[model samples]
Target: MVKDLVCTLKSARKREICCSRTTRAIIIDEPTPGLKSIFHIIILDQRSGKAEVQYQHDYVGISTCIGFNANPVINFSGVFGTNAFALGTDVAFDTASGNLAKYNAGLSFSTADLIAFLTLNDKFDTLIASYYHTVSPLTSIVVGAELTHSFSTNENTLTIGTQHALDPLTVVKARVNNFGKASALIQHEWRPKSLFTISAEVDTRAIEKSAKVGLALALKS
Candidate 1:
């Protein structure tokens, strides 16, 4: 399910802004069988600060894999919106430790999903840079790439190829236009179906003025 709404920030230091947060809850339907169901609750919130539940159901029947004759696995991926965003800053924090980012000396924390705030100039304008790609709902894969935009038009097809990996569509994130000036190109790498990433050198202020780099939440039943 996809829905959009407007949210006014009490302390918005930026104008062109984007942010996202994804949450999940899960439960096991049965645990003693060759195959059983695993239930999941998924939430997707967008730049507007509005959230929607996309799936509320059991994933494919589960089967244990081991000498014990059974194994369990859980999977979910949700993709929405643009990643090449403008930022006042993407206030990064170590959710596990509850420490907020200072945006200096490099943000050394990393995770599976994140929503970032970007800014250009001193206009208090924040660009929301998001990142996501499509893969099978339950299977895991390792994708890698370092490529370029390579083409353009009123509409452009963003592309990347693995420097060593063996997949063509290794990374996925659309080229997002910030303030009608330039597009921020983001590269991606997905591993084992649980980790999603985008990495590049970027100037939050120059996101709308020029090109830069940087770094999803998803669910399914």
Candidate 2:
């Protein structure tokens, strides 16, 4: 059977802006022995009255994930009020050398208004491909690249990442980008469906000005 992964944030506050309550509801939760699928709807509303004029924005999104036999997962989600759409799929299988490999492809699209949305003229703006390989029981590596293009501008990036199991309860991941940026994440499994993580990033081009660190604790049911 499928288990709930995590709880969504209910409320957030900023220095000058006050956000309304965020809500999420599960629309579908069909579970099988080796297959699991879930669909959720989320609503977010924010308003600001600190300034002379008030400002507000509302967004609604539906997201879904499907997994079969714990491999070849497919995911697709779109935000309506935000004017964005995304879809992706990943598949894993055993290679001829007895190694495991997974491949992924994803596409994202956006539009200026709901009327012009999903049209072929200016819909898709980004495409990505990711490949992962398990070299050993304790080590795995991933290489991915993405391309973003429009009528007037284009950008591309490539990333190489690896994960190593330090012990039964610890895992480390590091990744490097073509744009002189690198990041590392270390996670410790405190218990079932609970973990602690430390993530950090550094920029080689501007070491002092572009360094960041974060810590997170997560619990899932």
Position 170, candidate 1: lDDT = 50
lDDT tens digits, residue span 106-139, model 1:
1111234322222221122222222233233233
Best-performing candidate as measured by TM-score: 2
The CA lDDT of each predicted structure is 0.30, 0.50
Q: Per-candidate TM vs. native?
A: 0.17, 0.43
Error of 2 at 77 (Å): 10
What are the per-residue Cα lDDT tens digits for candidate 2 across 71-102?
Answer: 33334434333436554343334434343344
* Poorly placed runs, candidate 1 (over 4 Å): 1-169, 176-178, 181-190, 199-212, 215-221
Query: Which TM-score value belongs to model 2?
Result: 0.43
lDDT of 1 at 124: 21
